[model samples]
Target chain A: MIENLKEIKKDELLSEVKKYADAKARFVTAVCNDLGDKLEVTYYFNASPGMEMSALRIAVGKDEEVPSLTGIYLTAVLIENEMKETFGLKVKDIAIDFGGHMFLAQDSPVLPMLKEKKEAAGEKGGE
Target chain B: MAPRTIAPFGPQHPVLPEPIQLKITYEDEKVVDVLPAIGYGHRGIEKACELNEYPKNIYLCERICGICSCIHGITYCEVVERLWPVEIPPRAKFLRTIWSEMSRTHSHLLWLGLLADAFGFESMFMQFWRIREKVLDLLEMTAGQRVTQSISVIGGVRRDLNGEQKKKCIEVLKEVRKESEALIGVLANDYTVKARTVGKGVLSKDQAIALGCAGPTLRASGVCEDCRMQKYQAYGDLEFEPIVETAGDSYARAVVRARETLQAIDLQLEALGKLPAGDINVSVKGNPPANEAIFRSEQPRGEVFYYAKGNGTRNLERLRVRTPTYANIPSLLVMLPGCELADVPIIALSIDPCISCTER
Candidate 1:
């Protein structure tokens, strides 16, 4: 159930996630999307005793960096490092920085997920 | 004082069947820090989802974790189902519940065997696996395959359980329960087992929550939270409390899983008895409306989070999975430090590490 999608300014990312942490919400996971010019990052927080997911989405320009949540929830380090490696998103102050080597091995394609690809040659685009 | 040393536990080891290496730094026999090197089993399953059509992605998801393959497919279907807003038939819901429970039973049994082997209990390990074989047989009898039963489709289950199969399932579950109970009793009372596990690799309740551990690992640390309690699928119709132990040690984690196996059996029986007669699947057609959905399920190890975004095409725009073991790995860093070098394998095994799930 994804009705709780809340958009946050990039600068407010850490403070907003901290509010959920203060309210005893469990940090579920973070997802990053490459939107060509900007990156859309969503951090999911789950409230217990019920099945509600609150997501905080932030859009960062290609040259910009987003604050890390490892200071708030230690578990965020792994996923953030993964985002750093996969989506090529820059995260500041990770609790344990694997140095862009969490899920992808060194010497693999850089930002493989965000690499540009041509659309299907002659297929109709999705409606 | 003895000299400090760095010992690599495994990228490959006898106790660990999966590919995960823990670079443990120790001061003599006491562990000072642990660096987990994963990605050995990464197959880019998430990226592969984009390459396949939305429907065919079910098979891809099922391959993410072979041990919990049924639930992986089920959760994937549920995520896609949310986009379409299709109602799975009552019988299909119950069947999903039953099969999910069966997967849980088999997974827990398999983990119990691996943990026993980690402790050098060879005979106990074999006994657990022997019981596990019967569960696999029950799965095969129903779904036509043992491991990686691709039963769940985009809408519902691909097969239905008949009366004869139901009766046989009950019989097999009863035998598994009996054998597992005897083994659990041995693990609980045996002095050597207790001496090895109790008060070892302790993770406090606060630390467990802060680290985002889930399922048995979180429950063992007295969090009393379970994704099952969220009541997705047939869990709402079932009755069971999250098995929690306050000790927050290796022994507590073992006990939580052993008891969860019994809970899974009870859940399967309850769902089977309440199975209703109806269509097993609804006819799902067309692309899901442009939308986003997140589905969470309680896997044997922990909570699995699936996110799907459809752009109204056959292929989903994005499909991301955050598996249980991925969340539980951080807790290993919390637990591993300060444990004795001898207890590293048992403590690591206690998390029921599934690198395939984590890396996928």
Candidate 2:
């Protein structure tokens, strides 16, 4: 029986994770590390109520840096890269060896989620 | 120590099926180091999911891997179906299982053909592909499409196998089995194949576990971790164990896949015999509530992990797919450095590298 964790604010989410980590693999469910705006926080099997899988929304405000979890978890490396690519979040101490070519087009006009619309009747007539 | 020459193996090469370039540092005939260069086929499939609706994304996800298209689609649907909690009908489950096994048969046969071609056994390659055509015809007949069939949906499957189609499938499968048995006999007992493949590109059991290799690659190394054992579909009702080999080499991998192909035929026959009678689908209404579900399924290559996040909408918030080839790449890197340059293709093929799946 898997329980779905609700969305928790950043501060409370961090505190909960720290509390679980202090217990060391006892309370914490499998933490699926995803690098994006939403942190998919999960509780292990038999996690108590109010302690289900919670997605913590990380704020990307200027001068308010996102905390690095690399010191704590090895799987955060790929997560950090995905965050930087998807959410435009700058992560510190996250080294990415791109191996020469840029894989993500961060500034493309056609966002995948947005519906494609024809160009407005015109800045310029058909040449 | 003399300076070693560095040469890139492929972004495109004849021997390599997928576009994976290995920057190999060679000391004459011996490889000192190999750095894998991937992302050649990356289409940002994860990003694409954001744009497409959940139902439409099924097609998008199916194309994630051409060989294991049905499995990919089924896995994606399973994740979404979990969010809604729709109980798929028994007939649908049986149909899904049948198509899945058919896909597996064709995929394994395709792999065998490529493996044969990799070793320069051109005639064997042709014979295997000729047998594989029957499986493809069956897929087209039942699913109405050959490759990347969008047969599965969130609630249940989109199509049902009628009695006539089922009989046709059984006939074709029997013919395929006969042809495949003959081909398997030749490959299993042939002098040249054994001479070329035996004791080549070995990966010890410990190394395989340590590197987190999955599916046939790990099974070939004697690790028995198969997701199908969990029995997501009618696999629970059916009976089978993970096929394994203790040798952990290219030869073992070949033998494992070859043997598994026969097992697939048997599984299909059993599934068809035990085909249930009922409605194909239970309608799933409304958007899925905010939920996260993790689904795992064994594709032709290995165990695939899919994580779906829904926020009570037609469009899913996030869908992440971690394919098996990505996990196997590290193990492949380990195998390449010790083997000769000529043996590289066979060793790489042994892992069944699907760069499209990995890079997507």
Candidate 3:
């Protein structure tokens, strides 16, 4: 488990990200996982001058829009576009908004991460 | 204001080995902005990992990128092993370290060859790959394949090195280190290579860390950071300093990698000498429990991060991978601007951007 995981409300994300960015923490990628009714978004950072991994997680409802971290951590632009495209998380005011098509072609499955697909147990059909 | 000419750099280009495009907006010869366009080669590997049982995910993870496949396999096994909190035999850790270093050795040479090729030094490119072939031979002799060895299992490595193979590996590596010095010398001393790379694509120390760059890209900027320092897997036993160069330019990046190629060779030789006598793997029982764990390891490019959550079932509830290239891409926004268009390809290649690893 993430030892330094700090659970924060969705509203506190930008400020929390601001605090890490203020400390000049290296902004690692953000992970968004499909929870039944909501998406769990986790931002990972390695504290500056050290390798301690710290994470801030916020739970978001499906339709809720999260503020972009690109304002503070410019690296967020790509991963945010990814979260938007795959999980369909609405991130408002991105610096370089790909408009949910960063890694997806038009007519591709929309929000592949948002779907509740079943694991193919004891079967490897996609080879 | 000069009228901007926006050119799409690539979904397919001469410099980039894989499919990733950068929308380069140039004001005459100098670049003003670079917006990236990717996703041409996305295979939904993470989505596939979630579909398979925890044990089956190893194969899928190993294929994430052909060049860095061994490290991918090691990282996957390490992350899942952390879930079970499995204790691998000491011999296995050394074996993994040896193989991991072998991967780093070949990968750096391949990048060096590509970097030479990017600068239009065709003969140097051929020379670098010729040395890389030796490393590939060593990997194939030990693991049964050249690129994606698939030697790593959940608890430990699937194969072990007998005595004859160990002696042969040491002899071949020492010769590799000796031969590499001549080619690497050219990178350090060549005027044309230096003119093209020395002051180009400069990412400052602060920008490198703040932008989340990794591997040689991060180290070359003088951050004193490497995932190996965290000592996951067998790296704890392997004592070495992370290579650092302060210029933060493409040449500095090249020097860092050029030196690291030698370092990787030294590391493999050390691990081979320290090979312990014991069983290679421990039997892992039961499925992964309800656990969420994060693992970070140094690949040839930089550090790779993996997050896995098990639902107490055979399959993982969620699997996330954040590759080094993905983290380093945004730094291109910083590097490309203010560089002459002629220098773009070398600057892009300096990051050693593995788009297959990035897009996956």
Candidate 4:
């Protein structure tokens, strides 16, 4: 269970992740939740001396560019690439870019996991 | 100075059983850098979770990794149970603990064999898998499956362990313990094993924590962090302590997993002795409320994370898993840069990467 989620703006997300990184916190993973209008990104970090978990949440419009945290926490590289491929969100300065071939096949549907409800229905009707 | 050459380590190689391609940039015999290209085994399982009903998703989650199958289902159930808020019986909790450890034992033994094979220790590789078969037999006897034991559901376990089955399990574990002790002795002191592993692919404590290395990999670096210590199931009542090794090298990682195999067996025996009586499962009749839940557990490789978001429907809105191997992959990137080219296979196998688990 995650608690004390402070919603930071997109600009502050990297510094916030770095603050925890300096506290010897292990970067758990980052997740993107599609909230219809705006997407919410939550990065989970676990700190010890006690296995206490704290998360930072940031809401960005679907087209907003979120800065990649791979510079601060090197492990952020994989999850960031995944977020780019699966959700089709624009990420700025990822440490490694697979040029949209990280997980999806080139022949596969574009942004298959990011379809909005009505758009999904329209696509389904078209097919 | 030796000229640099680009060598592709795999998408298929004799040493690797998976489809991850490591494009290695090498200067003569020393590796200068490695760029790993994955996703060859991706099955789009997470997207599939949004299509299936909640209960049936249990079986789908179990297939995420054949090595650590039970934990995937258990973690999924823990997330769903949080949303549905089902209070499972005590008997079911104990059963979950037992089966999870059974999978841990089998997974670790399988890794030990594979690590041996990676370094060209063929006879030792056969010996380790020989012990692994007995552990698999115990899992099959109880859960009726060899690899994917679909005992976990949304509410609780799908089956119960009887008295006779319990006794047989203990006996089989005793034989496993004896066989493993002999193999562990060889792993610990054998000159060839030590020569290949002792100083190779070292991940310091600071680096392991910074890179978020999980499970035995983190523990081997003297981190003292284990998801099991969080005591999610009946582990609170069970006596437990995480095994830690200070060296943080390939041998330390192997030693930590070897010791953990014995640790998992002890915990299983203790849970079996203290087994309680009650229903193995409970019935749930509705969709989860609109909310999100996260569950973490100690899988054999490291910490496994499950995140589920419910939208008041039979199918979940989103299901995300951050497997141990995924967390450990960056550490591989850190370790590979300075090692000799010939040592790459041994170094790669040390983390016990399950690309299927990572790419799923």
How would you encode candidate 4's per-residue C-alpha lDDT over B136-189 as one tens digit per residue?
A: 999899999999989998788998998899999999998999899899888779
Maximum-DockQ candidate? 3
Greater-TM-score candidate between 1 and 3: 3
Task: Please give the range of 10 consecutive residues that has the lowest summed lDDT in model 1 chain B.
Answer: B226-235
* Pairs of residues clashing in candidate 3: B215-B302
User: Could you tell me the TM-score of chain A in candidate 1?
Assistant: 0.87
lDDT of 1 by residue, A20-108 (tens): 88777778899888788998999998775345778999999877888889999989988888888777788888988887766676545
Interface RMSD of each: 1.8, 8.7, 1.0, 1.5
Candidate 2 C-alpha error for residue B151, in Å: 0.7
Residues B133-172 of candidate 2: C-alpha lDDT, one tens digit per residue: 9999999999998898889998889998889988988888
Could you tell me which 10 consecutive residues in candidate 4 chain B have the lowest summed lDDT?
B13-22
Model 4 residue B38 lDDT? 88
Backbone atom clashes (below 3 Å) for every candidate: 0, 3, 1, 2
Model 2: how far residue B208 lies from native, Å? 2.0
Q: Candidate 2, residue B197: CA error in Å?
A: 3.0
Please state the Cα-based DockQ of model 4 relative to the true two-chain complex.
0.63
Model 3 alpha-carbon drift over 4 Å, by segment: A115-127
Cα lDDT for residue B48, candidate 4: 93
lDDT of 4: 0.87
* lDDT (Cα atoms) of all candidates against the true structure: 0.87, 0.72, 0.89, 0.87
Worst 10 residues of 2 chain B by lDDT: B205-214
Q: Cα miss at B85, model 2 (Å)? A: 1.2
Q: Estimate each model's TM-score.
A: 0.96, 0.82, 0.97, 0.96
